[model samples]
Target: MVDSLEDTIEEERLELMVSPTGGDPTLRIAHFLKPSVTSIDGPISNLPLDAHSFEDTIAKPNIWASKVAFNGWRNPQKQWKHWVHHMHSLHQSTWKEAGIHEAVMNSTFEIPRNDNLIFAFAEKWCCETRTFVFPWGEATITLEDMMVLGGYSVLGDSVSSSLKNGELEQIHEKLIQAHLQVTRSRARKADQSTWIAKFVDSGSEIEHEAFLALWLSRFVVPASSAKIVAKVVFPIAVRLSRGIKVALAPAVLARIYRDLSLLKDITVKMKTLNGNEDDDNDVRVTSLAPLQLVQTWIWERFPTLRPNPHLIENDAPRMARWDKRKKVNSENVRQAINSASEHFLWRPYAMAANGYLPCKLYKEEAEWMPVGSGLDEEVSSLARCVRVSELVGLDCTEQYLPHRVAMQFGFDQDLPGHVPRGEQTRKIAWENYTRPIGDTVLYIPSRLFEADVTKRYLDWWKRSIFGGHNVTKTAREQRSSSESLKKTVLHISNEKKADNDLLVPPGFRPKCNMVEVSFDDDDEDKQTLAKLVRKIPTESEKSLSRENGKPSLDPQVQSPSSSSTADNGTVGKDKCHVKPVDNSIRRKLAMEDSEKEAESGTFVHDSVSISNKAESSSLDACETPGLDLEARIGKLEYAVAFLKAAKFGHRSD
Candidate 1:
């Protein structure tokens, strides 16, 4: 017992030395930071001794040196730990000076109007952990936890009031239902063949739930707000990447665009309606990265040809570096401009005790946001330097500059091959897309790839499908059968507009009219008709004779007054004869006789026509009573016309 007690005491002593003041082990692990804590060169030394002296701290600015100090700094882990501790101390001092805690505790108290106060409040509040003590136990909470716990109290009352109360759960439910509907409906429609369909089917339940939750959160408080969407959605989007390739569906994308745009416009209107004279719109001032804002939309509507995961993972780190670099460059430009304006450096800091940086720093020219620029020379040449606060005017222009620029000059309006921007993309959507037949592929132009930087987008997309690139082979064949080959091919050309010079051949259908002749009343006419039918070769017989290498011969062309001749040219006479027919019947036969007469007088060019005429004449002279040749001829004409009508009259009917 004694030995154990001694060991415990020794351990407690070591713990005290390692982490003094009962602070977190992580924050307390700063040896080198201790020396700089009271150094005259340090930022804290510049602060007034009295923490509550508002005039000096609020008026002055301070650049919070990065924990890393420099890109080339050694032992980044240790250095960052120390930096966090120093920044926290600075944050607490500022909060004390500004009485922020006192303001939050009171419902009626107004926050400081200074931008620095708000900025520091938000930054420090986010980074620090709050200890909430209850009667039974104590709980450590992060900013997110505080957001849920405090709700309207933590987020401004205006935001809470503006949002529809109790709509969050309803929205989540809607999103879940929509996701399930998309998965099942798409799977059934495409036979579970699409990549999205298969992913939903094969993915674990946890992954699917995580995706739904992450996507639904986009409509929630912090995520919905453009200021923090990058910080919130980016990580979630990356986490859900394995199961879901696209960030959001097309419908969801449209909703997000409309919502964010409306929110920005509505904020000012709301303030005016509430009788607040503070007409300054803060929404437009914050720089929301366009690519990050509508990431899902870009992935769904304008998918890249290839996905480089390694490069994508590097974005956060690169953004961090760029942000730091831009801040330093902007400050340098500000200093030069201030010198030209003949203002003394009252306090040499980027941020005051409050969170806001002077607006002039942000208003520096786009060119000035880089290193090695002769800012001193440029500032000297300027006729005048505007006041720092006027820089807020530039914020309105910065709100959606990237998107505005892209729409006006990018592929949102005009596209290659003279095709419109959204048409080609919309065609290939899951609900409406139809695969083309026989190795035909969609060709999207390089100009249309403004949103996606994939070199071979089509090829990569084809490979991403479940059945490789040829998943839609059966669908293509079905489409080909339903539509004519010529029409189908032309439809593709017109829709894609990949080549304006493409020519579409006209479609055609062969015309076939079935001939029908009625038997005359006379027995002789009936007999002649039967004889003619027997003389004509059947279709099969004709084909068989051709296959046997036999030449086609015309049927016997014997007139009523002449004898019939065989294929070998031997004459064969028939004893059936008839008296002269009635005038009406003769008139019906007149056209047939006239044709024969014309053939005999004029050299008969067509032997087939001559044979038909001779057969008709024989039928006219058949030995039978009351044969109505006129009626038979009229019926034949009517039958041919009706056949043509039946073949092509469905459209009008």
Candidate 2:
């Protein structure tokens, strides 16, 4: 069945390529349909040659000395919550129809930045290929990352597409006028704060439009300034407000690529200067891209570097997991990245969710699907994510290469074939960027399974220059240190357990020294357990009383034959005698006490004060002769029952 699907997909791909009006006439299909290479004898073009050089640059103490900034834009104000709620309530169906409900809802969440982590990752990014070159393998922020983490859509109209009618233009003009009216200035740019204060909950027709403008300006493609560029973000906001779907993932990925390239270039320049430049001439490079996505990507892939993220419910945006910030220094982050080969998660999202349902694009069975203009939205989206193409953003155009990291897409990795990047291919053409232009045929795999690499790819990876030699040495050192730490912890725990065991008597010792008890809020069982535990004598108290020459607390050691007990007439004074009992008798007594307590609705408080008082009163009884031993034995049995009941709850007979 799978073979038939593959054949059908291949036929469709060929038909589409040969059709006169289907694909790009300037480009040839053979360029993309080339198979993976088995081996390479020389250096591959565009691949990073020296991994250690880049690693050293990032590890330097003065890497941040060149005024690098990755600060994110200001979040939406608290007062804007009302406007968001209103828009959600009023246009819930429209947002969903446009496939941006999750994006809009997710925009409200604040994703705190970890500048150190982002800087560490950006240092390793290869600008030519748009992937972070690690010793383990190649990995990059793909369209899937943008879609799943940033809540952006992979399938929609091009972000560069302009409105053909004058209605949207008029609405745009009204928004500008409103901004001008609020600011009372002739300046073209509108202050973000002023715009939100004037239009949020104003009950005007353009309230929704204004709210979307704020979202785009603050979140989608944020600027360094606090002002909103009406000419840039207003049109996209108007389209989104009118239920028009915009392909945001590509633009987002493009901007990230651009920022990463910029950051990498500046770092390289700083490295070239070797810290010899004057401080007065330092140039500050502030990134305007949404770098929250970059930080979230790092958190998802590298487990050791990130904080413990909050677990969200199923179907929630995955980005919500990292809503808090963690403090990290440059030294630790550099060390973690250096030894991240063994810990990098190639397919982080392949793990089964707690209660997740499979979306339309993901399935349990692997099959080949043809994706293009006429295909399903999910299929088309998947194709766009897995294909190699150019991503066009508002300000930049960057290359997208999914083949170098095929393992990320659930495909078996092979030697990556060279992808030609001619001038025409790099052009920022909206029509080329909007559709799934590369590899019309793609293999979709089950979400739960991760396909391993081919033997040839593995062999090539071992010999690849991009794989750093220092990575193995650093990883081995880290592993050895962690193992020694674990052994030290285990040794301490063992000594503590041995010390605890010496204090407990043989028969009364607990089965497990570490007792884990959990109780619900305000539960009756919890109160009952607490009362019983308070009554039992501690090991220290028992040892102290024994040292003071007081009568032993163990009921078995005390003689039952006493004159006071004989007066009760419970047992004949001459017939009754002390007898030794096994551990089974104590266990049976506890079970009987639990049953009685449950049936009669009586609670027994075996408190330390009560026991001390009883011992004091019975001091003479221990010396008395001709007393009934059986009558006194019953009292000791009751005391033992409380101890057992406190430690272990009711047991089945």
Candidate 3:
């Protein structure tokens, strides 16, 4: 049979009734169609119309009316003072419209006797348009006032016995002031902060001291109940002091502890209501649980064990996010690499050409490259883990699954190298700087890494003003290298000369007259000759004839045949038996010879010259067989000294 849509649906009947057990009691409010203003049937008591004034101008301004009106407004230095002034004006206007100022001054409302009455009073205030404009919620008592209510109300009997008359009012006033401080200041936006922060942030030192005084005001509570008072007001005091720095009196601390204890009890009560203890058989019977009717509860519990559907679905979008991040990182790394290269190499080289060393400048620039590169060490480590996972394949351990899964969707690692771009650039620049510059074997200094006007100024200060060392490290190194190169070049030149010597035939003497050639009179050549003469022996030698059975080389004593053989190179090979003598004896001998020549006065110069030449030839021929080559060289040097004396000594005389 074909049925209509309405016929297929089942309808249930609904009715209004009182609340179930543990729920709020129903309020029996009496609604009036056209009741007179004097009629009193609801929570609000009958107000004396004659005493109450509905006029907006009912209250008169105090002596400091203008100052009070513009209190925060005039303080241009205070943040959000103007906004506070505007809000105050709105509040004043609302108070005037609702006649709340007159009500507060002239009327007194009774505290509800029970929780139901209290709830009803609160609801009436909340729903009423006149009370809706009041701050700190529509209830007559504010959240701050709840502390006092804990002491006065039935719910707070345990702590209430501890509080005395007027103590609750004083606590409420202090709490309201603290709360108002946060709400009035710009710091009000951070309302979640502690009370100390809010209060201290609200005003200056003077205001802080004033609030501290309020906290110190003595309460009427007894000594025994002081502990209970402390627990009840502890949180309020903390809120008051949130942003404020003040010396809290012992009394205030005690009250704060009392308030806190009450709060703890209240919390326990709330938890008891919502916990398993409250899940009684009544709830089970009233509320239907279709899941309980299931034949297999085991299969039903499987859904709870399964992973969250949202989490599984999130993988795709999560990968896409990572892909986007990778692309950005890659771009950043590329830019950093380029910047680092410029900072490391090109910039520094340019600075060097300008005669500036900017190591610090390059260092500062290099430091920035890593920040923009976007690949922190964490991501690089993750990439390593991913690579390890890939190599290990599906058999890889579960620990690295996150990194592997992240890279599974063909997403490149795009991770930076272990060495930072800046460091790499510095390393490269330093390497190139240490090595030879271009084709030349000269190295550029690493100190000359970067350049700027500041570096130039510092260099100038270091050089001109301070009179510091002129040579830099690079310059010193170059100078030492050049000196080494010069020595090497000289050695190579000597090697060429030695090679030339190999072409000369042995025993083939070139008959060059050693004594006949005139010496150059050039100043440099004379200096060179003087140096060589100074190096030759200046001390006198002993006579060989003293130790030998032969006569010495004296023109007056020697036979012509013996002198001829001696002059001929034969005696040059024989060792002379001699003892050491002084230069004075040799000089005296030369003078005597010259005097004798002068005395003879018959061309003695010619004979002396011939004798001198013959002596030189024999000295050269005497190889000094008994002595080493050094002794023979010494003998030749002695002969040269004697010749100089015979020729120059007589002329001076």
Candidate 4:
């Protein structure tokens, strides 16, 4: 027990000496930090000490000087045992001063906003140790740095007695810097990830500007809004980097932003809305990096290629007509466009937040969204009425500028193609998502990755049996056989190969009019009827030879069944060998089938058209003699059939 106690005392002594220089075990630990923090609350404009009274004692902007002093110092007394807790306390101070805390920021986003908003987020901390030490001269101290440390010091000598509301005392500058180095050294010990290393390492820069912005946006002034950062990049770079060409990148990048074209008319409306014509609407700003340059280009071009087909139909109704020279098939383009417009070109972020996922938001529907250049309408559409706040995941009722800005700061962090991982990432969303899966996972939260970027496609129908069209409860279904329609109208009718240019050739369907050669069926009706059938787009018609009135969709299209050719192809090429299926009688049978179809609401069963006449059991309808007489008559009929075959040379004479 004595040995263990001695070992602990040794450990404590060495730990206390961590802030001192010259890495030796025997050096005395300095009483570096003894502080009594007056408080960490109230507006930036007002200070605890009256400036008039302290005018001769302090420098101009005493608060600013004190902050500079605090940054330069740390606890010389070695008060904090946990290194992480020490780092956390320093980080809290940064956040508080950087306007991350609410009281420091200006109400209007106009001016006087703190520049380092991210570093200002204050944390809850209390030190009941009641330690106090005021720095006198420069053993390892600057007046500014020492004054800043006083802002967080606990006063008095005992833990309970010095538990005053506030006190101001100094901390050693060496200890403060030493603490940061220690944490970074520990972070590098085991292999920590890149992001983790940055957070722990003092030398590491804040790579994610958006994260800082998001935290600070809630309280910072509006001058540093995402929009403004977007604009001032060039000049800001010029100031920071001192390079003319680097400064010009923002302008070049800005020009690349085609939203300028969208901004022209919007500027006018914005000016009117704000009651200020002098407003510089041309200055569209954002903190998003240059990668967004490509995204901006795509956003501009998408509106053209992905315009609602209905818009073209309404504007230039003839746009849907077939144009062979154009590489894109207009109808297919129409379907995809209509689908895209309904799905917002697969950008379901704004819509996915809601329950529904209709494919596109059409131009007519989008008219309300206040999109792009030129003022054609007086009233704005549904898009403009929408607020960025609704998408912010929380309410910002009052004017807390930093927090608001912070909310949007993550915009730049919404990295393209970045897949999020981890528990919190799983429970909520931090990455782009895909379509829903089953009842539990109904919605995907990912950004709208382009289809080309999606990398894989799967056959949707093969996984499940369609059963039949009636199985679907969806209302959009119709009796149209779209699959068959394409083969007939597109490939066969135009006589084009499936892999070739779009027109389907006529060899597939030799005759569009399967009508029998009886007049009074007007030519107009025949043309109209042909057009209707051709419009189906899938029916692959071809040269058909048949034994009866039924038309077979066969050249090589139908099955090998012998009964298939009994349809609309030329029937009975020879009278000799046929089983004597009377042509008129077969036609009469077809008429009866048609009547039954009409009465039953046209739900024609598969057997109705496909069954052969030989399969029909209509014995009672046919005239029959007595049993022995009927047998003799059947024999005579067979003999007659044999004689007819011989006469036509169907059998050897």
Q: Who wins the TM-score comparison?
A: 2
lDDT tens digits, residue span 262-341, model 3: 32233233334442333322221111111111101111112221122222131121111111111111222222322231
For residues 114-200, could you state the per-residue lDDT of candidate 1 as single tens digits?
222222221211101111111111112211111111111111111111123354334434434444554566343221123223333
Off by over 4 Å in 1: 1-252, 267-653
Query: How do all models score by TM-score?
Result: 0.18, 0.62, 0.12, 0.19
What lDDT tens digits, residue by residue, belong to model 2 across residues 229-296?
A: 44477778788888888888888889888888887776676666664457425655777778788877
Q: Is candidate 2 or candidate 3 better by lDDT?
A: 2
Which 10 successive residues of model 2 have the least lDDT summed? 484-493
- Go through the candidates in order and give the C-alpha RMSD of each one to the true structure: 37.4, 24.7, 47.3, 32.7
Clashing pairs in 2: 560-629, 562-627
Scored against the true structure, residue 180 in model 3 reaches a CA lDDT of 62
lDDT of 4 by residue, 123-206 (tens): 000011000011100011111111111111011011111112221111112222333453456453211122233343343333
